[model samples]
Target: MTIHSSHPFLPPPEDRDPVRRLRGRLPAPVSVWTSSNGPIRGGWTISSMLVADGDPGELVALVNEDADWWDLFRKTRLACVNVLASRQSRVSEVFARVAPSPGGPFRTGEWVDSAYGPRLADAAAWVGVRLVDADPEHSGWGLLVRARIESVDLAEGRIALQHLGGHYS
Candidate 1:
């Protein structure tokens, strides 16, 4: 007996630079992913989040493995992905700061948590999601996190936040 083998239209490995290819894509909307670690906690605003699955409510967020929030997320397995409004640009900046810096922007505000997740009283709107799964592979640092939507709170206005050129506007 003989078996037949066929190769499909597979791109060469050298031609598949996922990071470079993805970077060329336009910047995505930014959101603050908040997680708690007992007495110590932090949150980072990122634009790399993507909706993984819609039926069971799954998502994928590209968070740096070295990010301060990564460990907290790993431990607690819970977080709030806060979608900011156009007027909340300042809040976005606060969470976008690099780690290991004292007096960073996150220190300048009064932050609180809600049933959905952390809430910036001044933010235009926000939502909470419970982390379900995170898979980090070799893709310039990322985690495929599945979360369940807990709640959504919209401020008394409607505005969309956008990110471009490594900045929020």
Candidate 2:
């Protein structure tokens, strides 16, 4: 006797975080935050960020507290925020650890070393910053990163990559 259920075996979908799902709907820049601590180099893909205008200006971002990149960033307290181009989604995915980058993400991208850190050679724009560690609070799962914008570089007519709804927009 041969018997088989009409539906294929499958597990029910897991409950998704409403906050994360909702946040995903909002468009954000595809930025890579990079830092160099001595000989160690680290980078992380970050879209949870904001820019505040002031005398010195400020850029605040939420960073994964547990990420190795965060540890490296904390050491130097300085980093470069590089906004990727619209055509550089693969670079973002690589830095995000969502794609397989055999030699590492930096290996595939052109980079220029600066006072803050390594900045993407062809980024749409870049911001150099020094971390403000006044508050040690965690926002949800990320550590609240407040930075003083040290420098800014803008490239005209370049489209920046935007992420929304779990995909690039």
Candidate 3:
């Protein structure tokens, strides 16, 4: 009676996981995860994030452990998820370390300080969050960070960037 049982080509229930092959099949929005604490500024391109359901609402980001943002995230315990506009693919590429931008990634995009952290000036939207927990050994991919949303800034942008099949869509 369920689609899962009817689809023979689908992965078995237990085998269904966030494996790269599976994730690659799903489209995820591109975002630049940024954080700062007066002195240090760090950011990286991320596609694994979501606004989770809860009181006060929450944002969860799965950050690679080797990313520079990891330490800044810990130091600040705060961050801003800047949802990229479709035209900002270059900015995403710079942060993803895929392309060279003059003066580096920070210089590739306009940035401004917000109450929670630094946010992209031209982002489609931005969500500020304060770290509630960080699980380092989660899913063998990266740190699982759950944060409480503190602020949100929605701007005017129609086209949003998405990542799928190893490319931006």
- The C-alpha lDDT values of all candidates are 0.67, 0.86, 0.81
Expressed as tens digits, the lDDT of each residue in 1-169 for candidate 2 is 5565743443433656678778977899899999997667899999999999998999988888876788778889999999888888888998888888887778868987888989897789999999889445898988888999999999788899999876785
Better of 1 and 3 by TM-score: 3
* Candidate 1 lDDT by residue in tens digits, 1-169: 5554733554676877777556746767768888765556678887777765465555567777767887787777777777777776776767876433357545645578654445665665566676665555545555545576665667686665877644556
Model 1 C-alpha lDDT versus the unseen true structure: 0.67
Please identify which of the two predictions, 1 or 3, would achieve the higher lDDT against the true structure: 3
RMSD of each: 12.0, 4.7, 8.1
Could you tell me every candidate's TM-score relative to the true structure?
Answer: 0.69, 0.87, 0.82
The residue-level lDDT of candidate 3 at 147 comes to: 85
Model 2 backbone overlap count:
0
Ten-residue region with minimum lDDT total, candidate 2: 6-15
By lDDT, the best candidate is: 2
